[model samples]
Target: MSKKLIDSGNNAAAMAVQLAEAEVIAAYPITPQTPLTEKLSEVIAAGKMDAEYVAVESEHSALAVCIGAASAGSRAFTATSSNGLLYMSEQLHWAAGSRLPLVMCVVNRGIGAPWSVWNDHQDAMSQRDAGWIQIFAKDHQEIVDMTLKAFRLAELVHIPVMVNYDGYYLSHTYMPFELPEAKAVQEFLPPYDYAHTLDPEKPESLNTVTLPYARLDINGVKRPGYMDIRHNLHQEMRLAMEVWEEIDADYAQRFGRGGAPILDPYCCDDADFVVVAMGSIANQFHVVVDRLREEEGLKVGVLALQIYRPFPTAKIAEALQNAKGVMVYEKGLSYGNQGALYADLKSALYPYPNRPQLHNFIVGLGGRDIPTEDLFQTLKTACLNGDRNSPEQADTPQWIGLQL
Candidate 1:
């Protein structure tokens, strides 16, 4: 049985972690991610959750604790935001490269030299190449459901998974969502059964220095080189997309929540124009799509990307093939070039002969408000300028909600 409850996104994630029965939680508070770890600590203290809560000294140490726990065959979790996530950068790579199946919640926020404790996707997007599976949640329910799914996906692929959602937008906002029963979550996710672990009885070195070429072990068994190990990680990451799709289907069958795994399309089947985004911003586009459809008689839809990494190139390309135009709105960009998602979408559609015209919009950095009117106008302009504008004009990324 599932119970409907109204709660903040952070609490939603905490509830999922409780249901997932994480054995070890290593956390250091960083807003808006602080409340999540706090809630977890509270549950453990109240005897509602059976887990070891380690309050670490810093964000780096937080992930370090999780790494140690996960390495020892324990289901471990951690949460952080903005600089905290950046501080754990090295451990992020170590967790993935070591093939530790751990899960983390990254409440997305802007990175700072200017120093603002606000919301953006920069924190997670900056770590796009960190070899971890990153999944974004658009609402409270997704926060709950995806957190549960993250543990399962991580264990299956033997890669760490980051469940990301907008910092204050989703993290602090309260919304109603169904909290799945502990029994149901237990049935969905099995106990962690890692094949390799740091057992003193069976001593072995892990992630030690590797030579450029394959080497023979003391027992004369052939072992992979640095490049070979990296290549295998890449292959497994790619394969994880299919694995996620299958897991999503099974989850939907049992829980009736997650059918669309990679790309969640809202009325895109017959849309002439599609707006693409991730996290809470994508949820906002639903209203924009409806207004354009009903008020302006335009066939526009919204496509929210659930999985940012593993790219899902083929599926994305196929989904947007029929549309005449696609407008990608992002909260983060790849500084020198363009919005990361925009660049990726162009690459995905490059092989198609009749690819749609693409446009990129950067919005809502440092907790800036992204009003619905702004999205509505920007999209309307893109629709009006479709295919007629010069290549340079269309290709250049535009900044929305910019005052200067």
Candidate 2:
């Protein structure tokens, strides 16, 4: 039934997983991500869900349990935050290497030394190379919708997928969202087909013993070789770009309203200047773009990145084909650099003859609010000069909502 209800992003994620009908769930919950798995546990206790709830001691075992569940042909999921992600980091790659279509939620949060419970992208970005098909959610609706889609995509491609959303911003924030009809989710994603299930009657070995660096020849002569498992995983990650988009196109046609993009565009066709961003910051920057356009009559656009991992370079370059300049807004810094997204965008558009000037603007670090006027001012300043490398620069992330 199409219906409206308010939900915190974490709760919505748990609800999505239940509706998706995963067979097993395992996790060592951390803050922000904790309430998500906690709700799942409650659902399990109340007989609402018939999945196995494996309460492991550490994040390592949580993911280990997921791999084990998936190996036995059970659709599985888990959720974690910050250090928990890094703690399960090794298992993340293992899950992918074993070709388990495990879907996990990473409530985006700041990583700590002094310790923090706030929101940031450091955790997810730190685990970026772990071979998970990463998708970022801007709002609670995407959180719910994308979590369900993550499972289907992971199963189709035989790779692990992580749906990342900001901790306090999305996880705790309430917003109106409609739960998709069961028929819609069912049609969108059928049941899991296990070609390698570990059934007692038809027993098969799981991510079993492999000699560290050994290969057997046809003549039974053993040769040495490292685990090239990562190579295969890399290829599958690349394939996600095609499979996910094709599936999303179908999904939008059937169930989505306007539908979100791997890179959602806002006025980019003929705009000379564009502001590119990802996650929560993108939503704020979007409002800023509208004001700049309406109030100042400037030709500007906003390109919000929904898919962060496969980086979506080709699409970005093509979309910004007419863009003369770009201001990149990022919540997390690249450390020793202005912005990570800035560096990546610059690299992606490197070969273009008429590419953008690409000015890097870092803002909203550690739960800071990014205002429209700050973006308006930054865009105005970037417009005044074409030199992105000028020594007397206009802004230092332009410090939105800050004291001079």
The best candidate by TM-score is 1
Candidate 1 lDDT over 1-404, as tens digits, reads 89999999999999999999999999998888999999999999999999999999998999899998988889999999999999999999998899999999999999998987899999999999999999999999999999999999999999899999999899999999999989989999999998888899988788899988999999999999999999999999999999998889889988999988899999899999999999999999999999988888889999999999989988999999899999999999999899999999999999877589999999998989999999999998898776788999899999998888
Please give, for residues 1-404, the per-residue lDDT of candidate 2 as tens digits.
76678988888898899889998899897998988999999999999988899999999999999998889889999999988998999999888778889999999887777587788888888887778888998888888888988898899989889999998889998988878887778888899987888899997666666666778867999754445665667777887888888878877887765355588878777788988887767777667778777887888888888887878878888878788788887767667655667777878898876676777776656566666777778777786564655543522344456655
Runs in model 1 lying further than 4 Å from the true structure: none
Per candidate, the number of residue pairs that clash is 0, 0
Q: For each candidate, what TM-score against the reference? A: 0.99, 0.91
* TM-score, prediction 2: 0.91
Q: Pick the lDDT winner.
A: 1
lDDT of each: 0.93, 0.82
Quantify how close model 1 is to the true structure by its C-alpha RMSD in Å. 0.9
